[model samples]
Target: MCGIVTAVASQDVVPVLIEGLRKLEYRGYDSAGLAVLNGGLRRVRSTGRVAELAEAAAEVHAPVGIAHTRWATHGAPSERNAHPHVSGGLAVVHNGIIENFESIRARLSAAGYVFESETDTEAIAHLIQSKLREAGSLFEAVRLATAELTGAYAIGVLHETEPECAVVARRGSPLLLGIGEHGVYAASDTAALLQVTRNIVYLEDGDIAELTREDVRITDSAGQPVERATHVSSLSADAVELGIYRHYMQKEIFEQPQALANTLEIIGGGGLPIPQLFGADGPAVLGGVRQVLILACGTSYHSGLVARYWLESIAGIPCTVEIASEYRYRSSVPDPATLVIAISQSGETADTLAALKHATLLGMTRTLAICNVPESAIVREAALRFITRAGPEIGVASTKAFTTQLAALAVLTLTLARMSGHIAEDVEARHLAGLRHLPVAVQKVLELEPQIEQWAQRFAMKHHALFLGRGRHWPIAMEGALKLKEISYIHAEAYAAGELKHGPLALVDEDMPVIAVAPADELLEKLKSNLQEVRARGGELYVFADAGSEIPETDGVHILHMPEHYGMLSPVLHVIPLQLLSYHAALVKGTDVDKPRNLAKSVTVE
Candidate 1:
């Protein structure tokens, strides 16, 4: 998940580049760098944060430049491996991986080009420079060079010879051109360009654009000229600002109620949701879908896992949830009647996109994308999509995105249940009522944050944690464990409550903390027994129980009551405390809560 921002403007763009990189810091990067075409190509890089890079480039100024915040796909996170990789007069900053860089590097090496870095982007710089010798212009050279490269990439290239313009290309990764009065800019996300301009042109895959101060020219993958529509972005710069919250993670954790409310606003009129809420052709798609194959990764995968229970039990549809990365590589039977639901917070997740394509290649035509970003690649590729209204989730550890996704999936479940004649009218109305009241319920759960923060004080001293849940809440436990491990840097694992004695109980001890999600569902007694297993093993227990489960507090047991149980939607409420726990624990541990180590938001590379 690298970030790119390139500008060819009338005024000095160094400050713009630095500010853009600051906006993209939430994507998670190890190093930052920029190359400007002044009289000559001037470059600066830092193996630190963007603020440090800004300090290093304080005196540097240029009208045309390319900048990057690198996430280190091809090499170690060092200044030498940072972006704005140069070859002769050309400099390149890239997002996404170049899969065939080894062969390109080998050929460039044989051609007397010396390599200074171990990055695939370095090979790209060399290849583009070599092409410039034969091609007439920088844009032509970039287009020709990209044709030979393999894998996903969005790259911005600047040549000192072509000081008036910058060339940008997009393949599998996202790249947009910002049209401003004084300049044209290219960036990986709109957040980076929002400060300078709201007018944006989202480039299609394999489209290349040449940006100058006053003009932008586009060429498609086939080398034919084309035009892409420019739309005014609705997102303001303040959406990314951390107002009163200490970190983006904390801010996002508290924004869940509003996010869910916005996502479910279509059905807020006290009526059953129609399938068309998903897309224009949702009725036909849902009518043909006899089974579901849900594909997703990370937090999105946990959402899909939770959906498996809902789809099967509520809609009476057989469902299978697969981790996107593994699903793409393996051969499996594809059913045309099965709806392939690809879930992602940022719609650009590489594995999920690849798996969606793989399923399509196998002849599964009924595909739906449950995502947050409307312009993301997965949404464009899927036949139908439900865009969650969780606006601009800047935190690397997703909170609002996860809850909004659950809200969307719940609506999908009810729609399918109504279509399949699996639900009575009264039952459907009750489910609809629960969804209508979801935001209020979530807000009440958020009210318990202070108590959860106290629990986090205890958890911060421990290095290992185990999360347990039963039935549908099992995936909620999994999500809870993931959040703890992601932000708090704790070794956490989740298990179905019944599976504790099978193997995981061996690791439970007095020093280890066990967190359990105990909603007052049918499995309350069984989950209570699982907590007893942990208590019997001298494992310190922290339980987030329902209001009336009556799981009494005793020695070695700490219980924080949720506002209410929420029936089938309990997973939505249960996950909030876990998110708060992770956030507070990370705060106590002095870790980066928004940008966790060795992880990035929107995983664009394999």
Candidate 2:
């Protein structure tokens, strides 16, 4: 959840550190800080935005520095809890939790080391400083200190004594080394370092790196030297910029069409779905998959829920979807014939990765990953993977990532259905045609943003909302509700239309606005009855209807017609207006649309 950037350069690096923090703002931070070695250690921290920290550090400049944007974990968001925690001559910025910090704190406290802030990172700084007497250099001290710590962490350490070098270590959190002409840098994400370098070295789980202006040295956990290949990054600096959009959320919402097209580009030539689309061993793995168990968290979990409907209906396979965090703790029946699928936008999701490992522990080896990042931990762990080309989604509330995930899952569904001999050639052709036309459909749906924004203006005034859908679209409704609550700060919930009269009908009133996904599918009449139930209760309605749904706008019911009914792929299109609605509602309310409260883009900690 936190961000770390460190550099050892021939020139002053304070401005570079601040700029890197600005690029990492999407990771959702409450405090920003930086420490540099300019003859002595100089540190500045702020509990506000990075710009505030930059303003405060305007006079400080150095050739070696480390910076951090922190999302609160061990303590409250305050200047005292900000990173670049210093002890002795060392300053540290950490990205993940230290599980055994209490013990380490007690030990360090017994040695008469005072803790300035209530943070796990301060313990790390003290621990590294304590090792300075026994270790030869700052890198050695950091490596020794990390051996005693137990938990996920990607830490950057700077020592005033070693003015020309910075040390960084990673275990369970992401960290990368960047090679630039004038400097060597390290960051938790490539976006933070893209301004300085295009060449990157992705460190392994226990790798420790020492960066200097001239070169970088790497060592494994056991102290042996190692070599890591540097790859040229495909991401451009302009890709992360919010071009004409007011916020990154709005920009990502509009980018969904291209994102989906890129994800589904494999089958653009119009052919039967093949297993190799997943990976080289996809054929061997898909052949033995008689049942499916999908594991994911957040929006990715909802995608799995949607996939359950597809797998059972089209592929004729029994499917179950589980929340990854919960599934990892509880015991469950594991079948050898079951395929375990893990879905995540960033495959580094802590819970999802743990759940995948848990599944492997249970002897379920038929693993697959549907993720956006190709080099993520989950993708590397799984036997098969389908990487969605959603590019980099900077917003905390997912838009393009969700749609790209659905596009990838659709391809997975068709492949399995074909393997099971459950699809006719003509039926496959029709589905392929729908997928080929999906980008156009998504663009047409984006055209309804103006109408959705008008609806959002009304929603901004309301505090509660209820979303309704049926069948596969039920998951889409859940995703919509999630988006609204994520960015707008509105309390929202979703229900399968059939479950309305069971208990949710009692909550429907004039104060609560009910939104419905009214696609003209087989369940249209049943969903129409559910809408009528809301109308009977004086609940104001906002319905997104298909073009031919014939759901007319009356006194209490507001209808925004979608461009078309996209058959099995309707969820991909139905979700766009909901995303726009959330973006506009957050905009109207003046909330931070990209970095919502108490949320992080990539959850690296449990």
Candidate 3:
């Protein structure tokens, strides 16, 4: 998905628009452009970062304009395909795709509309221009144009005839209105306007709003006036600052303790979670749930896999984990009593949202979302929600977000256990105490960075790496491999320690590095034998072992001891070093740790 920002302000709004686009660069960074209604819609665009567009638009004097940083969808990433697509007097910037654009473009072409850019967004501009020529209001023209479209979109449009007014609309995509002292703004996300204003109104599906410096008027698809509640954002501009860390990933890794502490705040002054943590209907949903189906993608999917272990072992509930992208395409048996949980950091993940809706369509009405953003689509769509407090994860490869998801899932596990009569009070109390001490344990885990860095130095030189673990820690190994491949650009794979000789051992050699996660659990001896198999084959071992495991370092074998054995919460603590290893390896290889190539922070489009 792309990022869009539009404003109808009292002062010269170009500077504010540029700053907003800068903040939204994490959403998309291929190319950027801005259009101001100065002397009949003057515009500047670049096939570069937003900074280049800011430099090009330095002289824009109009107080009304729209801007976009595009992640290419219907065309190549070039200056010609950059957003703020213009036709006649209409300029449009869009986030989602126009699925029926080919048909619409052919019709418009026959009607004597000349297109300049290879973009679905350009078709919208021409369509709007055609409607505006019918002698109707701007809002009416946009409404008529949107009725013919067939896909997801959050669009901002500005017409030269009415320079002081801007119109924005959303359908199956996110758009928020920022009410500020000097102007009203529309953006794909709230982070764009956090610096300028904290008052936000999230537009619902099929809603359109016309904005000006003095007023905003929202209406539904039927042209009926609709009331939208305004919310004051608690996120200050400073929370997003890098603040001494070399990269946001590094900063977020260090922020894990704080994030987890905030996430665990719901279990305050008591051994059990606060009744309101899951919402008003939480108890009924958890108490009535016959099973659980978790839908997620990427890092969230790995977190869901870990939660499967917790749900089955601790909560005594049957649980299944599914990748959102694949789940939507397959026909699965749905049980109405099942609790469908969707895990997403942005909560706007396209496939995950589709899968949740698919489940709902199949008579699975009981749903919950463990999301980071409170106002995300997944939160609104689900019947219940748990908001993780990991704020502003700007890294393309997730760090704090993954750890916080695990923390929230643990809370869910304990709550479900209490509801299901599977856990005793003493066991629940012990788990609560363990959760309380989790942040401190994670902080101590951060102390292993220098040791992990020494290991990363060796890893940076290897082209392929093997990550090994078993049981609950198996998902942690998958996450470790994901982080390494995502940031460091290394080819890494994960396998269960017991599955080494099954097939993967054939690939282990002197050139391959095998990373093992051995926490002194019941399977420690079995894992030791697996490591020996690798060592016998001349595979260098980089082992992260707990103190009780007593795994020694000899010749080709290297060991970094963990602080302590964290029992049930070992996955949460064990993931920290893998994050550090990935970060350090990427740093040593001179990779872009924050914005990895070919990846966006949020996968809002499939």
lDDT of 3 by residue, 1-606 (tens): 578899999998898889889888777469999988866888899998888888888767789999998888888899889988988788899988889999999999999999888889899999988898683889988888888888888999999889889999998888999999999999987889997899999999889899999899999877789999999988989888888999889999999999999998888868664357988888777777889999999999999999999999999999999999999798899999999999999989888999999999999999999999999999999999999999888778998999999999998999889888899999999998999999999999999999899888887978999999999999999999999999999999999999999999999999999999999998999999999999999999999999999898999999999999998899999999999999999989999898777788877777
Encode model 2's per-residue lDDT on 235-343: one tens digit a residue: 9999999999988888888898888888888886768446548877888888868899999999999988888888888888899999998998887999878899999
Per-candidate TM equals 0.99, 0.98, 0.98
- Greater-lDDT candidate between 1 and 3: 1
Q: Write the per-residue lDDT of candidate 1 for residues 178-197, one digit (tens) a residue.
A: 99988999998899998899
**TM-score-best of 1 and 3:** 1
Model 3's alpha-carbon lDDT is 0.91
lDDT of 1 at 250: 86
Worst 10 residues of 2 by lDDT: 268-277
Of models 2 and 3, which has the larger lDDT? 2
Hey, what RMSD does candidate 3 come out at? 1.2
lDDT minimum window of 10 residues, candidate 1 = 268-277
